[model samples]
Target: MEHNKRFLLVHPEISRNKYNFAGIIDNEPLELEYIYSMLKSMGYEPDIWDGQVETVSLAEKLKSFMPGYVYVCGRTRQESFMKEYCANSKEICGSTTFVGGIHAQHNYKHFYEDSIDFIMTSFDMFAIADILCGKSLSEIDGVCFKSGGIWQENAPKPFDAERLPVPDRTYFYAHLDRYRYLELLPCAHVRTAYSCPYRCKFCYRNRLNCGVYSARSIASVVEEIKGIECENIYIIDDDFLVDAERILEFVRLIKKNNIRKKYVCYGRADFISGHPDLMKQLKEIGFYYILVGLEAVSDRYLSDYNKLSDMSCNISAVEILNNVGINIMGMFIIDLDFKPRDFRELYKWIKSHKLRHTAISIFTPEMSSELMEQYKSRLITDAPCDWDYLHVVAKPSNMSVKQFYFHYHILAAKLFIKGWREGIYDFVDYGFYIRTILKNMFGFGG
Candidate 1:
């Protein structure tokens, strides 16, 4: 075979059974698209296989494309699938397999399997290009590779969001109709920053990029937005509402350039509560939805999580977003120490706030988070996938495992019923979700 210069990039799918809300929200493979853009600039053939939306099997793609290099990326929940894809690619074509993503970046050792040739610990696409072009593994920075049966890792480099190339977005445009965030159909993912600025003790995002926060200029962000075809843009920043002046500039630029697009982004409750005027300005500039982490209903739990936001702040955030006519996706965490009354209180809080869109997740101690050590001895399951926030990985302090799950399911059911009565989430089939949740409940109990 003439020196094959083709590269295959993959985004693995999550098992529906493992994650009940699998089909509710699917984002574009923005990372793989960036890699694809870089590869194309180097005059190499690159193709993306998004398992989330693509009907084609990885086996078929490997056989047909016969790529010399295969790269796969995913989060902690999709770790098994990432490994499976790498193993399959290696066995099918003997291609050099690589893995990279948020999960792999922090837990690179988790992917030191025989089939995977390299693990990318940072956003260093040039290093990959060099490796493909016959450069030695020792010469690259931000990579882990085996040499003579021993694994060696190079020091990782910090990533600059402003320096990133305009992502090709070919894959995004190809399956534009399939991507979504709840009701926002055909949604697109855009990144304005790398890692997070706030240091929430329970969150793993703040630990990324060597704990450094870098953002692109507002002008650059707006320029990229101009090229995006989708009207619904999901800004994948850990927290987009961090800087006040930057957001004001973004709103000004969006209006000045006459680029109209609805945006969905992650934000902190304290920021929203403190800057009600900015929230109004954001709504005026087409910010349709903001996902606020109202992690708990009590200040004690909030303080324990080091969230630095009180229950009053969360309530104010809900009121502000509601007044501004922007949808508020209230995200809450159910602590392991909760009793039946805590769940009831949470439901009552959501009901009283009149919030139609809510996401309730069990308090999950991620393997990469500093809180893991505190809960390590109390962990009930060693399985990596069980840490997805849906499973109660740690033993509950005030209740049995069965009781915890029962109350959790009851809370979910009550929320779903309320949302349904209020005529929300019509885009999804409630019956299907209910069935899936029930199945998971019984399966977990058994």
Candidate 2:
């Protein structure tokens, strides 16, 4: 499929685990960069409208961009609002449109009805391109659409990640402050690899072992980093340190350029726990925050979430990072599967670990991986995609959703209040709550 085209990609601030908003890490929309590069590769231009910094009236923006297709991706949180706006955008533009991402992909036709023309789920970008190039949705894979009052499914093609060009970081550079936590100039987010190679039950990318992760060559990656003239960048790799040789080459490239940018990337505790000295070097090379998923302080509990990493590894990794003077934002998941008694231990765990700058999200069934598989089996409620539900997703193996949410809320409240008293997080400090009180004259977290 080959034809000239143009597109507009919109990403909603949907909740991955509901509470992601409570401790939002303002970041650039990498999906836009990916699609921008892919569209540019296919001789098309894409304008991205990210709704993170400010709410965008997409229809008004669409009139200016006049794209051939408008694409939106988000899960549970703001589906109704997004669907309404995307439908309105299509109506206003009089152009065909598609909506994707996990929520839409799994239940596009079921949810949006006549609003969306096409839905792409399960890493089905190629099929989407083909459809936009004028192929029928029936011919694509990982797409769903309503046809004659029925939802039709297609089996489409998936492309090799290495074949794709580096995401044009210009869009990101143009919208720097919109990213939540960066206090730098020329901040860009770069994805080093396409799919993840983990089997963590809560993650979205591990939907199917996608493949032995194919990585972009260090030479190619560095070319883009330098080409962008970036003084700082966020290595948006799911886990760049997973592949050590690539890590060495990547670090070497930054060292050679002496060109610098602060980087933030996700990683497994096992990776850092095993290579503290190397990670210390990465920090000097602009890797500011190594966001590790220290899901729990217990191997048994963490294993229940399929974290794979042992509790000792998680602690050791955090210790190493702190010792190396690297700021750590340890992400932990409080299970809905435990009793109220679990909260005391978890709090003790956090305090003992001195885990400041932490984030807690309720578990959610985001992708089609183990989480969703279990969710659909009546094990967990589709865990509402609301921003508040960020951490505990569903009925735990042994607790009701109500009991789970109640205790989970208590735990988070304890953490936030404790930190507020001690001045742990900046944006979420007491000042923010005071402002909210003055504005809304109500308690916070509404």
Candidate 3:
């Protein structure tokens, strides 16, 4: 590959079912922005096409730019689209295609076929830059590529979060309005930390790097926030509210700089429960929404999932956020062991708690998680793409497959109506809802 070759980064279109975007949220392609910035810094002409935002044909873009390299990134659910796009790019432009992201990080072997030329095992920006600069794959720190028809791998280098650059938001200028967190439109994403300190069994963060918690400097984080053009900012940390001192310092920085963007982020229930003052301070500083993983309604499910916190903690956290006038986007996992009564109980619990915004996902033990092995025997399908958490991946223990889906859709519709009553826009067309209901009624999602 030439050192100064043009590069095209493709964010492959994924199934709407996987993310269940339903037009409620369309996250900006922050990962691509990082890569684009890194490549540009190293003197490479790089451009991005976000599948979620861009309507243009990737093939046509490839033909126009005629890049020498095409980089594709996505999660396990997007593996099929990634491979197909890579193969198509290779067929069309004969570009050297490289794959990365969560899917490639843990499952490089799955990408060893001819369609994929190299797989980046770590998202270390410098390592990727080195490879793109035409450095030999063997010399690079975290990549796997074929050498004389044999797949060879390199040990990944330690990622220095301190060196993370301010992302190139200009790339997303055209469709900034589409990205959001509910009503918080034109949202931009910023990362304050890497992995979570607490290990939840069903989470995918641990698989990226086990027990690793690295955070960017406060000044750096604030600088990124200041540079963001969008009114809403989503700190895409696994858990942003872990450290009390850090949160205080961050709040101080925001106050010092007078950065007043509406913020949404992930936080633990225990953190909010223990720090009511901090919650109030966050609200005072424009933290309008907090996405809490109230994973289950029952303590038994919480303990089984190693959530570490109990139902009381979750309730306390919600109450605290409500007191501070901050919206709670409560996330829950549907247990395969759930009976018909369990669904009704959870709905009742949500309603009784006055939870306006909620998100529900089936209990899916994703790729590379420790739970995958235990859940393997009970898996409904062997396809990697089907483990998206949108589908009931495991066999239902208490109800028929159809019955499980029936209750699931009922709850989803109920949540939608509740959100609508609370003024959450049904962003998609009315026909889309009709089609979804029809599909669900016929038991199609599984």
Tell me the tens digit of each residue's lDDT in model 2 across 1-446: 22226678888654432123433356667766777778777777888887665455676687777776777877556676567757776687755677776566555554555767777765546665677667866666677777787777764344455665566777667665556453444456776676578878766654421344656788787877787655657776667778877788888887997867777778888998999878888878877777888987778877876777898898898898888877777887766566677767888888888776577766666644445665765444343444344434445776766566566666666777777766655545465544533432222132
lDDT of each: 0.88, 0.67, 0.82
- Candidate 1: segments with Cα more than 4 A from true spot: 1-3, 16-18
Clashes in model 1: which pairs?
none
TM-score per prediction, in order, is 0.97, 0.83, 0.95
TM-score of 2: 0.83
Greater lDDT among 1 and 3 belongs to 1
lDDT of 3 by residue, 1-446 (tens): 65336888888665755235536677788888888888788778898877877777887887888888888998888888888889988888888888988788888888888978889887686777777556777789778988899999886654666777778887777786777767777788898877777878888785554347778888889978887778888998889998899999999999999988899999999889999999999999999889999999999999998999999999998899888999988999999999988888999999889888798988888776678898889878877777677777888898877788888888888877776677655655656665676677576574
**Lowest lDDT 10-mer window, candidate 1?**
14-23
Q: Is candidate 2 or candidate 3 better by TM-score?
A: 3
lDDT of 1 by residue, 1-446 (tens): 13477889999876544464656799889999889999999988999998888888999999999988899998887888899999998899888888998899888999999999999998767778777777777888899999889889998888888888889998888887889998888999999998898888889888888889989999999999998999999999999999999999999999999988999999999999999999999998899999999998899998988898898899999999999999999999988999999999999999998888999989888886778889999999877777678889999999999899999988988998898888888888888878866776676632
Backbone clashes in candidate 1 total: 0
Most accurate candidate by lDDT: 1
